[model samples]
Each structure stands twice: as C-alpha cells, then as structure tokens.
Target chain A: MLAMSASDESARSPGVLIVDDDAGIRENIADLLSTEDYRVYSAADADEALHVLEAEDIDLLVTDFQMPGRNGVELIEAARKANHLVPAILMTAYLYVYEQLDADRRKDITLLRKPFDADEILREIAARLGDGNAPKR
Target chain B: MTIPPAAGPKAPPSAGADSKPPGNRRTLFGATILIWAVTAGLGILFSVFAVAIGLQAATFDVMRWLLALAIEAPLAAGIIALIWYSRNMHSATAAGEAGAQALAHSEAKYRELIASAPDGIFVLDPQAKVIDVNGAGEELFGLSRAEIVGHSFMEFVPPERLESARSYLADRLKGLRATELYEATFAAADLKPLHVQLRSQVVRPSDAEPYVVYIVRDVTAQREALRNLVETERWASMGRLASFVAHEINTPLTNISLLTASISRRVSDPEIQERLKKIAAQGRIAANITGELLKFARPGAISPIETELTDLIRAAVEQTDAFRKPGVELRDETGTRSVVCTVDPMRIQEVFVNLLKNAYEATPRGRVRIRLQDLGSLVAVSISDTGSGIPPEIQSRLFEAFFTTKKKGEGTGLGLAISRNFVASHGGDITLTSEPGKGSTFTVVLPKQAPGVRATE
Candidate 1:
C-alpha cells in the first residue's frame, strides 16, 4: 500500500522505502512515517523492495539486515549501483552481522538493533535526510 | 614358611641360627659341637682325677706339686664353658617357637579381612584364573566359593568386553601395570547382565607367586541415578526454549505494538475498527508470549539492590493484564507508598507475574486480588483468586515440577516450581492455602533486607 502523504501529490513528500520480509514490520514502518506526512513505501522482500526503489524517487532506504535472500546490505549496494546515492539504515537483531562492512561502504549507512522504539527510527531518518526534503518531526 | 618381606628377600640372621639346616653339613656341625662339649667335660673330670692321683702319689718334691696345680686350674675353666653353651641352646629353641606363632596369627588376620570386605575381592593367579575369592565375590557372581574359585575371570566378563577385560587382567597379573580400573558387564551365574566396576591391583608376595587382587562394585543403581539427574537437567533446559525463541518473538512483537497503535488511530470505519481490534488481540498474544518467557526464565543475571517492590508489582500486573480472562479484575492492593526490599527487581517481577498469571488462569472472569504488606522484618505478598479452589490432596504437590492440575497442553508445570526455587534462594518461601470450591491464595514471604552473599554479573 502507498502510505498516503499529507501534502499534495504535485510536491510529494520525500520518499522513504522500508523493505522487510515481515509484513507487520514493513507496514508498521510505513505506518510510522506516514504520520510525518512523508510518502512511505513498503516491500515484502528484496526483489519487491528493489522494484519499489526502481519505480519511486526514494530519498532514504530503511531495511532489515537479514531477509529470506540477498540481505539488506546486498540490496542497498545493488540499489546504489543502479542510480544515485541513497542513504540507508540497516536494522538487525545481531549486531555482529555488519561488523565487517568495509570503511567505504560504512559511510552514509547506519546500523540499528531490532526491537527499537519508533521514535528512534524517525530521528535517524530525519538526521540522514538533513534539511533536504526532511520529514516533519 | 612365611618370611616377612621387611627382611628384604632373605631370612633374618638370628632366625637362621635356630632353623633346621637342609643337608649333611648340619649333622656335621651338630656332631662337632657335641664332641667339643663332651671332650671339655671329660677333660674337667679327668683333670680332677689326675690332680688327686698326683697329690696322693707324689712326695714333697717341688716339681710334682707345680704340675698338680696347673692341671686343677685348666679343668675348672673347661667345666664353666660347658655350662654357658647349654644355656644358649635352650633360648634359641624358645625364640623359634615364638616366630612361628606370630606368623600364624598375621596370616589368619589377613584371611579374615579379605572374607569380610564389603566389595567383592578376588585373587587371580598369573593365568587370569581365579585362585581364590572372598565371600562377597561369591555373592557377586551368585555362585558358591567352590564354583567361583578355579574359574577363568573371562568366563564372567560379557562377550562384548571380553577382549578388553582379558588384556586388563593380563597386564595387571604380569605386573606391567600396578593397577587397572574399568567398568564392565558381568554375566552372573543366572546369566543376568550386571554392571560391575573393577579396581585391580598387583600383589607380589615374597618368593611366592604374584596375584591380581580385584575390588568389584555393583554400580548399576549408581549409574541409573546419575543418568536420571543428567536427563532431568536437559529436560528442564529444553522446556524453557518452547516459543520464546527470543529474536523470532521480538520482531513480531515490535511490529505488533507499532502497527496496531498506528492502525487503531488512523482507521474510523466499523469494519476496519473490528480488524484493528483483532490486531490488538494478536499484539496482546505476542506480549503474553514475552511475559511467559520471563515468568519461567531464571530472571537472567541476578542484580539485587534496595528498591521499591510496589512499582515492580504494578508492572508485573500490567504485563499479565493481556492474558487475564476478559472481565477478570487484577486489583493490586499495594498502596503507592514504597515497599522497600533488597532483591533482584527482575526476579521479583517474574515471581509476581507468575503468581498473578496463575491467579488469572484459575479465575476465568472473577476477581483476582494482590495484597502486599510490610511486617517489620518480613514482606508478604499474597495473590488470591476467586476461581475454583484446589483439592486438599493435590494442593500438597502443587510446587513439584511437571505436576499440574492444568490439562496436558496448557502447562509445562515448571513455572511454580521455578518460582518457588527463586523465592527460596532469596531466603524466602511461598506458601499455599486452598479449600475445594472456595478458591486459593498463594502467599510469598520474603525478608525485607535479603542477606547479601551472592550476585551474578
């Protein structure tokens, strides 16, 4: 579902795409960002998430580090190769899974542990967005 | 004859003097001593007679008198030497008898000790054949002493272990190894398999054959008990792992709370509203799963500090609210005032949650009340439910693990047992009071200040 943005379609709010195998978590992230009046995109897996990235003008990418196939890290790298630089946040239950990310790839990418509060998620997305089409607090 | 090994593989010099010699050399020595003694005695008697004859026959000549004096002095010395030799011979005979008696006494005592030993004792000769066995050994094989002796030890060892058992006995008897310890199955006289532990030691008796002395113990009962203890611990650990596969539960729970909160706010239509309630219901189920895991967990690492338990009690009540039957009231009678106690806040919360959950489970839609009190040194927390009370007979065994009044799939039956353990570990106790059809109350009494000796980091 396209989480309805509060503003008009002509100046669509900056888009944040959330990709996770879990429907509840994917929809909840979308649900959380929708309150900020930003257009939110939800995808069930990496294939679907990549499809959304291709179709939308996604400004921020939020993805779970572990998925059924081709985890969030691989998805973001693939997404970045196709087009422009999109800042990413990777949520994982295991922190050690991302410890080996090279110095170059670590830049503009944030690691978040799971079972996190929704407020924290909003803060990170806004920080990554800076003032450029940043969602309302 | 038994020669004590303390003498270093040789006969004592004093003992040899009294022992009978092996060959004609002994006869020669005896004859020589007799001849010398007799010659000395006869010389004494002849010297006396010669001295008398010389005195009677001699005139007052100086030469004759001198000769008579010399003869008399030599005879007196010979007689004195003979008397000393006779006294030595009598004492040697007495010493020999004493040594023989002492050897007899020690051998008898050793035999008695082996016969009365608790563990089966068997003496095996160099060929691994049983030379002798004690009374216990006979009982161990379920055979008479005559039947057990002169039998190869390999006959009693089960076929599967025969090779190892053979080599072990061979090594011990050859003195290649001083001792051998092993567990093996023994085929008793009735052909029943028995688990026996053998401790075999090499005993080399002086100048005699070496023997392997085995101390055998029937360890079947002991092994069974040890196996049961290990299995019980494994079952207990596996029991806790049931659905709270932590990470699996957490992701869904995180989604549950956030998505349900969002849906309930945005949607206003009755149809969507009904679906949102269902979302809340699933969310509550996830929350219950987390609470149940904590309720059964050892509260993780223990962190005890002085804190108000009232807050903890209220939090636990809130945690269990989702699981309570609809319309069942969990009234926390604890006032807002701090009921201070030194304890692991997490553990106390777990105990409270477990008790409240039990109360909620029993009372489908009735009232469950929690009351806390500070009686100077002791703090008492009581949970009472208006559900059907437990029977008098079953209530006594309520705290035992795997003993549950709840139907099979409903309970692991370990919750109360673990809760009671936690309470008791903190120098506290959980007491139960119940009447059939009148509901039940479980009271947990803890010291206001738990004496501190242990803490886990």
Candidate 2:
C-alpha cells in the first residue's frame, strides 16, 4: 500500500522516522514498515526523533502522543515549526485525540491506533503522500 | 310699689304680686296704658261733672282692674318655660349619636390590621387554644381558619414533640417575660413531618389575662439541602485522600510482590513449594489491588490515534467475559460506520473495560448490553445490566473511592471512581443511572475527535 517516488530510481529509498516511548513498539513498527522497502529511523522519544529528523531527509513520521518530557503532540508542533511541511501520524491507546485535532493540522495528520494492522498503516502512508491508488511507496 | 319696707314683709307673694313689675313687663306696659286712659277719663269726668255727669266713679274702677293684671302674669310665664326645655332635649340627643359613630370606626380599623399582617400571627387564649389566626397563619399550618380556631395547640404537635410544644406555650403564658423562639416538629395532613420555628410572646394590659402571639416559619427543605451538601463534601475529601494513600503504598507494594514471587519459585520441597506458590499468588493479588489504585492516582499521557469505535467496544466486552458465568450473556449493539476518532486507544480501551466489568458485576447471570452510537463530535457508549439495581442510599456515593456493596475481597470500589477520573482527563464523564429491582445503565461519553478537528466526512 506504499507508493514509490519517480526520483527513487536516481536517489536512495524514502526514509520513515518512528518515534515511540515504548522500545518494543518502536522495533515492531519499524520492522513492519521496512518490509515494504522504505528505509526506517527509530527514536525512543521526542528528543531522539528531532535528532533523527535533522540528520535525515525523512518523508514520514509515526509517533506516539504521550511520552516523558516532551509529549508526542508537542513534538509534532515543534517539528512543523522547524520544517513547514512534514506529514505526521500520531498513535494513542486512548480514543479521543483525533476529534480534537485542528483543521489545518488535521489535513496533513493521519491517525493510527496502537496494535494496528501492518496493511492499514501502509495504506494510510500511501494516501497521505498523494499517491492515489498506488500499491507501495 | 314703694309704699313701705314694713308693708313689703307682710305682703302675700302670689303670682300676681311676684309678677307685679319687671317679670310681667308686657302686662305692666298694657296695664299702665289702661291706667293713663282711666285717669284721663276720671279727670274728664270731674271736668264734665261740672258740665254734665260724663266721667263718673266707674272710670276709677276700670283703672284698678288693669293694675290687678300686671301683678299676676301666669299664662305668659308658662309658655316661656316649655320652649326652653324642648330645645335643650333635642341638641343633647344629636351629640350622643355622633360620639357612638366615632367609636365604631376605630374598632373596624383595629380589626383590619390584625387580619392582614404578612407574617403568620396567631392569637392564643390563656387556655392555649387558638382564638384567631391570620391568613398567613392558616396557610402555613395547611388548615382552614375555622379548623384551627378553638383547637388546642397540641393537636398539630406530633406526640414525640408534645413536651417541646408545651414548654413553648408555657413561655408565652408568662407575661412581661423575654420573648422566646423555639422549633418544633408538627405532623402535616399528608403525614410528613414539618419543621417550624416560632417566635412567641405574651401581651396584655396591666390587669388583663395574657394572650399568646406567635410568628411561625417553615424551614424543612432548606435544612435538608444544607445537610446533603455537607455530606457530599465529606465523601469527596475522603476519596481524594484514599487515592493519595493508595499511590504512596503502591510503590513499596510493587517491589514486595515481585520479591515474593521470585522467592516462591526458588523453594524446594513439593508440599512446601505449593504452599509458597499460594503465598506468591496472594502477593500478586495484592499487586493487582495496588495496580488498580495506581490507575486512580496516575494521569495518562496518550497521543491521538484513529480507530473504529465498534472494534474498541468489542475488545472491552471480551475482557469482561473473563468474569462472567456461563449463564450470563454479554452482547454488543454497534452500527457500521467508519466511526472514526483520534484517541489513545489503550486508555479508551481501559474505560470501556471498566464500564463493561461494572455492568457484568451488577447482575449475576443476567444480560449485559453494550451499545455505541456516533454522536457527531463525540461518541456515546452505554453498558447496561439487568440486575438488582443500585440502592438509592448507595447510588449517590457510587463513584466515591472505597465505597462498595460487595464483600471485602470482591471489590475495592475504585473501578467506577477511576473510570470517572479517566474519562474526565480526556474531557468526558461517566454517568450512572439506576432503579432498584429493575436495572442500571452506565454511560461513558468521549469526544470522538482529537483536540483540533472540525468534523468532516
């Protein structure tokens, strides 16, 4: 369910950053998204994810909203301030965060539930990148 | 008239003599005129006697006849006395009627003020019976003015409060004493007890019997409301302290349970080891208690993630089945929709599980119904149980920590309370509606979207 860029033939594979407080969750999601041929960078929390984003040309971010120190929502806001256009998907165990999203941010933001299916995550990433009807990204 | 002082004393004081001069002025005037004519006649007679016998001795006799009328004027005096007496009698009668009318007007004004006073005023006789009551007084006692009048004050006073009522009446009977205010319970016609505070006094003239004046006010509802407010605050503070205590105890408790389980695994003898396993099992149960306790105290940090509500609700139902018996039926009513919302799925799942567990426990082998409806910006989920519903006594305190109807080992009573707190942290609330002997429905309402979305298809 991921679409590849036309410039992919000339350059490296598209990079995806994974930010979650739980290490197990970070590893599991990174492995699943990697099977679809996207390069993956994993961060334990907001601070680590910011370091990864600065060093890499990341196309997508999948982060949990709640974390120690800087929370996931705060991290998303900071990332947007640093780079004006970056697509992000926030993960939550609790159910009510999506309804609270702002209209501007919601247009770019996609939500994924915890313990989510691999196929569902891949398809959401494909749709958000404006690759309509593509099988892989 | 001036003949002699000696002759005045011997004269008879008849009406003719007493009216001889000023008292008989008209008669005197007429008599004098007659005398002058007679004297002139006598002189003419003397003169004419020389001419011819014209003025004779009869002329002198006519003068004496006029003098007699001047001395007694009986008919004229009688008429003056009758006229004076009649005029005095008529004026005296008119004055008496005017005085009577003024007295009647003042009495009517006194009656008006007594009847229309704003506060209830009751006039009780010395015998402690109601002599008069104002409109306000009759309305307060829920009795007609006629029913209350002439009735003893004891009739409305409940039997339990009769002594208090008598002491109150006794104070009113003591004239010139300080006024006393007392509260007493009275039974209404509907058999409900009423609370009344009366300010009563005895009023009287210096020599008259004392009359009781009572002013009554009702305060039953006001007092009850105040009591409920105080009771609620007490429970709320207790719950807050319990949560803090649980948090403090949980840290050590976590280590203790872990150590006990490790030691139980190291034990050697089979029988001794089995007993140790039991000990570890009990320690683990204690750990579960602290875990639930921590849920109440710790705040959840979660991110917005989209998931289907029906699927989440089903997961809660599945968890609830662990405690349900074979006879129990756990069912879900979920409509097909994207039913999408961004939430912390784990926390939301926790809330659903708590509600479903509560519904399962409320009924024994009864049907549990789980319903989910997408309500625009939010979603409403209801978990209902067909069990002996919550008693009214406990219903109000159902969310209070450590308040439970279950046996000591069965419930810590923090499930609903923690559920309430968890829902509130996400800007939602848990509400419980119950009817005794019928059933109970617990509803959890959560905002379907995250913080900033304007809902769209």
Candidate 3:
C-alpha cells in the first residue's frame, strides 16, 4: 500500500520516496518530510515501493536494507536501471551489510545505522537535496 | 609284623573316613608276617636235621638254628621297609595333582576379572612393548589384541608427547615416581587423539623379567565436558550483562536522544540547538552500543530450519568479499557437496560472516581461506587468514563482549561474542588456533541435529 502526503505547494516541491517494512517508521519519515515542505510518498515493502517509483517522480530515495521481497540495495539498483539518478539513503540495523557493499555502489549511497534520530536523517536528506529550500526540477 | 588299625573313636571327626590306614599299609603288613613265619619254619627244619646226624649235635645244632633265624629276620625287615617307601611316594603324587588344579583355577578367575574391567589394562614388558591387553584396552586403542600385543606402547602416543610418556614409564620402573598417576594424549588406531589418565605400576616376578601394568581411562569426553561448562558459563554471564544493558540502559538512552531531538527542533536559539545536538550524538553512540548488546542478548529467538551448510558458508564468503584488501586473496575451499544440518540460518550465517569479515580485515596483503568439512555427526567450517596472528594473552579474551583489538569506531567487540553464543545455542562450539607471528584459524563445529532434537543413526 502507498501513503502519499502532498502539501499545497507540492507541485513545485521536491518529491521524496520512503520505503520501509515498518509502518511506524515509514509514516513518521513521511510526516517529517512533508512538514519540511517536500512531497512524501511511502511504501511498506519493495513491491509497493516499485509501484510508487514507476508512478511518481521522486527526487530522492530513502529505503531500508532488510525488507520482505527485495532489499534496499536491490531497490536502488532497480531505480537506477530505470534511469532514475535519484540520490539514495540506505538505513539498516546490520552494519556489516553496509560494509559489504562495493566501493562504487557505496559511493552514491549514504548509510544510517539503526536507532538514528530525526536530526541525523534530516541532515543527510538536506545534504543530498540541497537544504530542502529550493525544489529540484 | 602286623598292621595296626587307627584309633577310631580317638581320631578327629574332621578327618572322617580318611583317618583309617590305606590298603598299601595292609599289604606291607601281610608281607612282613609271611616272611617271619617262613623264617621260623626254616629254623625248626634245621634243628631236626642236626638231631638226625646223632653225633654231639645238641649245642652245635642250637647255635646254627640261631644264626639262620637272624638272617631270615633281616630279610623280612628289608621287605617291609620297601613297601612303606612306595606308599609314601603315592600319597605325595596325589597332593601335587590337587595343587596344580587350584593354581589353574585361580589364573582363570584373574583373567576374567581383567577382561571385564571398564578401564584399559596393559601389561608392558620392561622394554615398553605390550605383552598383554584386556578387552577394554582393545576398545580404547580401536585395535584387536593381535594387532596391539608385541607393539611398543610408545607407538600409540603422539610424537609431541613421546618424551613425556617415556619419562613417566622410566620413573615408574625405576621407582623414582612417588605417584602412579599421569595423564597424556594417545592416538587411537584411527589416529584420533584421546585424552587419557593412566595409573601404572611395575611388577617384578621372581622367575621372570620386570614389566609395567597400566590402567588407562579415557578422559576425552570428560575434558570436553569441562571445557564446554566453562565456555557456557562465560557466555551465559556475558549474555546476562548484555540483557542488563539492553533492558536497563537502552530505553533511557533512546528517550534521551528522541526527547533531545524533539526539543532541539522547537528551540530557535542556535546555542541550545548545538548543545542538544551534541547530547543527541552521544546518546546515539550509547544507543549503538546497546543495540549490539540486544543482538547478543537475544539468542533464544532462534528458528532452526534444515539448511545446507556449504551454501550458507558460500553466502558468507561472498558477503565478506568486499572487505578484502588490494593484495589479499580470498579462497573458497567449500566444495559443491551438500552437507545439510538443522540450524537457525540467520544466526549461523551471521557467525560465518563475522568470522570471514575478521579474516579479511586482518589479512591486508595475504590470503583469506574458508573451508567446510563434513564430520559424520557434525560439520566444521574453518576461516583462516594469513595475517598477524593473535597473541597468547589476547587470544584468551577474544570472545569477551566489548573486548576488541580494533581501533575505536572500527569495532564494538560484540561480533565474536555474539557469534560464539549463536553457535553454542545450536549445540556447537567455536575454537581458535593461532601462532603469534604466523596466522590464525577459527573453526566452528555444529552438530548435524539441533540441540533439542534426537539424533538418528
């Protein structure tokens, strides 16, 4: 299932995709991003996330590494295959999995180990999406 | 002479019918009586002859009769003496036969006792060659009596232990050792090492050379049991500590980080925001540590399933491949053969990944090798690295929680401790063999059947 939150100025705001198997985390991130004046799209698993990716124009991808069908890495790879050069953040409780990523794959991806707060996630998002002030085309 | 009967009523009842004189004594008495009668008859005949001659015969006839009677008496006494000598010889032969039967019976009883004893018994000649072995010895050595006898006892001892074994034997033989107990490793017929306790003594027979008798008890299982107990206790205490940290400290740390973030977002002052951020950052660090602790604490969540061991190991090797340095070579020696076991795949996979990652991290410019072996009742996976091996002092504490040789941010030190707990929950164990300057090998052995499941033949 998809949960979309668009502000009145969402047509000009950057769109962000949040994919996680956890409903609480996905909705919380969506709420945070929406309040920061970005349009938010959320999915509970890789399959739902894939549907949103095909249907929406997302400026950034924030995904969890461990999920039901495909992991965050595979989802990111799928997005890249579809010519979406959107920057991505991979959050995981398993740090070893992040260390196993090749240098090339790791270069474009930011890692957030679990139990992270809103500030860290917001900081990483701002770093990728340019302070969340101007909307990306 | 006449044979005298034994006094019937005066004889001890314990002697019973045997108290009577034997037939040989009666025959000797009869012979004596006949010989004396003949001697008397002959004397009478001689006297009559003298009287018939009628010339001053009275005195001379009497003297001649007396001489003849003396000669007859000596012959009769000699016959009796011969019969008595033969009777004594017969009795002595009967007694010797009874003694031989008793000795044979006693030897058979001792042989049975030795054969049935649970501990291995070895009778070694002074040269240390096995002259005799009991049934238990045969089972312990995994060899038959024919295969063991005449072989040097030293042959079963491992090469490194031969000196100590020889020393012990020599001391016992020379009576220099005050105690009869010693312990050592012995290689069985299959070349498997056995930990054994030996109680031995030297036996010197008057008619034969001195020999050593060893009573060997296999203590391999007992030693393993003791090591397992110590290991289990260590992990259990570590787990308790992890549980305490996760339960008591984790919730507060999380609240501190979340509340600080919430407050920082609302506050407009830059100074307050910066300080709150710092507090949040420290909370995150503490939370990270607690997160690892939770993983170590919660091993009972294992969901065991039938999984192929080689495939699991392969996945781990692949996962850790990215950690390999430029000049480090990773070798997968796990063959294509499928070795299936009941295990929690996620937990076991984590164990493999942890070990492999450590190997790759340690070997910056050498080789990292992983191999799988199917040991009938169990399976072993070994991860070896050609890196600077762990030192003796650090090796003992390698599996301790929060004990790390790595620089601060590189490790939390819970990887090995958690991995060991995971493997142990599966009724398996992890062992390390390392040489200071050479390298290290970590072996994880898992039972084919899960801990609570009954094993099938």
Residue B245 lDDT in candidate 3: 62
Docking class of 1: acceptable
Candidate ranking under TM-score, highest first, comes to: 3, 2, 1
Tens-place lDDT per residue, model 2, B372-454, is 88889998888888988988888889988777888887887878777776666566778889999888998888897656422
Best by TM-score: 3
Question: What fraction of the reference interface contacts is present in each model, in order?
Answer: 0.49, 0.00, 0.20
TM of each candidate vs. truth? 0.42, 0.47, 0.50
Q: In candidate 2, how many Å is residue B302 off? A: 17
Candidate 3's C-alpha runs over 4 A off are A1-137, B1-78, B125-129, B144-147, B151-155, B158-181, B201-212, B255-282, B303-405, B420-457
Per-residue alpha-carbon lDDT of model 3 for A1-137, expressed as tens digits? 34355656566677788888766677667655654667788888878877888898788899988888999999988888888888899976555566567788886788976667777777888788776444442
| Whole-model lDDT values for every prediction | 0.73, 0.65, 0.77
**Model 1 regions more than 4 Å off:** A1-24, A35-137, B1-232, B243-246, B249-269, B294-298, B310-339, B360-380, B384-388, B391-441, B447-457
lDDT of 3 by residue, B137-160 (tens): 999999998888889999888999
Off by over 4 Å in 2: A1-76, A83-137, B1-116, B174-178, B190-193, B205-208, B228-319, B327-402, B414-457
* Ranking of models by DockQ: 1, 3, 2
How far does residue B337 in candidate 3 sit from its true spot (Å)?
Answer: 18
DockQ of each: 0.23, 0.03, 0.11
